[model samples]
Target: MTDTTTARKPPTSKNSEVHVKKRRLPDETGIFIVLVAVLLVFSILSPNFRTIDNGFTLLVNGTVIGFLALGQTFVLLTGGIDLSTGANIAMSGVLVALVMQAGVPWPAAMLIALIAATSLGVLNGLLIHYVRIPPFIATFSTQGVALAIPLIITGANSIQVRDIGFSWIGQGRIAGVPLPVLLLLVAAVIAGLWLRMTRQGVHVYALGGNKNAARLAGVNIARTTILVYAISGFCGGMGGMIVTSRLMVGFPATGTGNELFYSIAAAVVGGISLFGGVGTVLGAMIGAVLIAAVSNGMNVLSVQSYWQSLVIGVIILVGVSFDTLRRSRAGRPVFAKRPAVDTPSLPPSTTPSKS
Candidate 1:
């Protein structure tokens, strides 16, 4: 007689090995495609759109907005918004003009303007981080204050810039490229590299991704917040200076409403998430280019200004909607429909008879 015995293996837990299928992260490919499409459409619609002079005009017009957008990207990545950027530009221009008129050297005046603008940014950060004010409300209040300072200082008047040296920053060209455009490119490159290649940049993304988690992970939230806003102010101030240089005048209302709208639009359209923690400076620059292209194309086509505004509004809505969708999808599991694989069972064993 022989006896047969078999041992069964215990079933593995479903959670024992989580096979998470890796999905590609959302990128700025959609925006880039839109940009290319817009370019092609405009080129086909208007014969003058491809001309060099028109191209220069588009780039020049885009410079100020590009600078503001760059700064906006930094703030947005930190899960914050700055409505005061335009005011900073206005205030900085006004202050620089007033200082220059008072016999200060152009360089010194520019420095003072930058310092003032950066100070306002610092104030915004302090208000948001230390005082616990909401980013929107805080920046909005600061915008009013910033705009008022310029209005009060210049009595809502324009100050003509006679200093030729200062004007060169906006109008001069190096190797056939406009100075302002070149500056924008340099700044964009620096910002993009910093965001992609540095530890601080990672912290900004991490902070925006989850504030509490970032805090637990040792991110210096307060400093990062302050730096973010300060950079915005600095960029705004630089933009104001460039505008003043280009126009040969510094008006109390230089940037006005256009500043806030265009800057935010550029960043948003460039694929920066309003909810924060996702975007690139290069993308923001491309967004600025797209905006400039649209405006230029509309002008060439003789479209009404009001219609242009409507179009811009539509673009913003579309960009934001896309961002929302991308974010939502990113949050969902990639293997939601993955098929289960059954664990193999052990075969029964036949024992030899002990006869």
Candidate 2:
């Protein structure tokens, strides 16, 4: 009698094994290189883009997006997103301008706008945390409300800002640096430090990483959620102030434009994961600068606005895909997997022949 086995194993040959190349550089390194390459390419293609003044213009123009992306980084770190930020810009911009026109002092009006925006964020938090509404739906609903508020109040007309001091916020320079740019830098620095060194920041990360685990570890879910959204709102309000200051006008349609989309794209492109809990302020800011550069370069080259949108959309797709792949490969072994080879077993001999 003979025994036989039916098991077969995958081949162990080098060809049979899949090979995943080791990452030669950190994730941020690739995006940083891409940014440099983009700058170089545009500088080579457009002489106008190589000028110092144009560089400053790009930085100024990116301020709103940078602010939105900065706030976005906070919400994303907590595994949430705030779609209402763009609308917050519209709401706050129009609100500030309207109140200023209504005899409120410019400084006071600015305070009111920031408060309104923060209140909007708080509403979103309450809905998401208390009512159990999903972050997406809650923010989307708030976005609509915010978008409509400015239009209803202004009748879709642009409000002219008469306060010259307001211009200082957007147009003034300190040591040849635009105030808005400087403001964004200061905010980014503070945000980065808070996230790295603060206990609350750790709570935000834990919440995003795993809600249950974080809860078990005593993270205050409601406070973290509300706080992140509120911070996002504050950032949105700052963006609103800058927009209003820059043009000396509050356009209701400003928020309805590509600002929201670009802000999200900047965060993702900068390496903020769509799934959350895995990104940095520096990366997001770099992503913002990259998007700004692309936008400025396109304008310099006279590329159509629609084409710019297409390029940004492509960037978003690529960034999300990269993030997804990274997550999937998180725990994978360093080398490609291989299995031992197996040979078939012989059948048993006939008992009659043996007898």
Candidate 3:
């Protein structure tokens, strides 16, 4: 006290105390809440909406496109689009149906059908990865091809599958759960685990976040891109098989307008950004189920079919808008900007902080 000595404090490092708050996981939470709200509303409006029969029907019908959305999730994770999913489904359905009629065993028929579908997917991948074509153009071109192939094979007709064994896989229930739904659930679990806990999953997100950075990080961008599309094709094939079993027929018209619903709805509502780099498999499944629920509810309520389409379109817009907003916020990091390079020169020692 008598000497009036003061100790100087060392400068604090800005990096040590970042004070960043944890962010909420994508808009999927909101979608889930909305789904619950929708179900409640529909149940209140139409008592039939809560019926067990309606529930089972919804599960069966939703399984086909639900699986397609799983593939869409993969493609979108790699910042890619697959416009041919619907067409792929149609082609697979027709192929399987026609093959089953040719005295081929059901399992063998499915193998051939899946191979054909994967080939189409491989073509898309090659065009996008090797030929350097934009994914949009590549998939769209393949979409036309997918649509044409089924027509060519079936001559614009439907091929019915009378095989009871094959039909059971599509419609059978185990402990009251439809087989298709069970398959979808299993696929979801596998896809979710792959994306969340595997190296390839990390690579997919990294590539979507920044392709150059991902490549620099030793991620095989081209291969991942190719694989994502191939996976999408495989999902379509599986969905097609389910559809064939459900109807006991495979028509060239199978899955028409489905690509629009599965891709747009699942990707957007599941928090899979259009700009890429974000999504979850569980979220995609939830999104698909929500859309399916809405459609089913509308049917129960006797709402016009066109009105349902309009509602779905609006939901798509809302989802895409939310995704864009979330991505923008996520990219705005606390330390995103560089510090100022030129600090003002201090005046010749303002009393030099004497000790």
Candidate 4:
């Protein structure tokens, strides 16, 4: 009775604690190395490729795809893909131009364009979450609709944009930096902070890592998914507006197939997992720059457009292959053998020899 209230501890020893080594997760380091190598190769191939003017052109062209890739990163983090991003860009640009042409104020037209783009995202989310459609099929179907809307609206022709103020967003430069490139930088910084420092960002990673586990852990899957797609749409819309400003017209076929290819390729080549739960906006931006560099290098070297396309396709394949291999390696056991355990024998029980 005297010791009844005392807690009895179980056996403890130095060997009781077992240390486990975690396998290092794959990251963008390899991609960065590849980017450096590509840069070196290109720089050596053509003197013009290393020129400051060419560098600026690369950045300017990369900005549009960079924004699209940034948005794609959000969707990819949630284990989803948005095939409709290109179409959303086209439709938003067309709508904005039409509204502006109708004598609407630039600010209001911009807002309307953004809303229209985001609305497509909402519709995509609803189809996936509510109707239980697969992400690819859902987005693919909507892609057709998005592409059609612009064609119908503009009768398949480019619409002129007369708004001088709107043009400044894409054309104006500050401190000798292109406005579009500056916008891309700002967007990348904000997106990077949000994804790395916020709770919702953690949820996104968790959801992508294991959707069932995330749901069990109380992550709001529907809301997160919807938000991700909406972000993608917003980015696509911004890209469209920039392009429209640069061209001084809203081309119904502006983005078309190229947008989808560039956005997805940039994200993948930047080390973002096609399976999701991994990647960084900074890597995506670097990937965009790499792509632009390749294109510029090819142009400087007088490579044919078809050859450029082939090279890009090969790059995409190589990046995806690396990603698949990385994932497969992650699934293997990090430590092949378990730590050995030592157990001490109990002292002979003298009382048991009562016989």
Q: Model 2: per-residue lDDT, tens digit, 8-74?
A: 6866766434444444345565467668888999999999999999999999999999999999998
What is model 1's C-alpha RMSD?
A: 11.8
Every model's TM-score: 0.84, 0.84, 0.84, 0.83
- Clashes found in each candidate (C-alpha, N, C closer than 3 A): 0, 0, 0, 0
Give the clashing pairs for model 1: none
Where is model 2 more than 4 Å wrong at Cα?
1-26, 316-355
Query: Would you list the rank order by lDDT, best first?
Result: 2, 1, 4, 3
Candidate 4 to truth, TM:
0.83
| Candidate lDDT (C-alpha), each | 0.85, 0.85, 0.80, 0.82
Q: Flag clash pairs in model 3.
A: none
Candidate 3 has an lDDT of 0.80
lDDT of 4 at 110: 90
lDDT: worst 10-residue window of model 2: 334-343
**Residue 310, candidate 2: alpha-carbon lDDT:** 87
Best by lDDT: 2
Candidate 3 global TM-score: 0.84
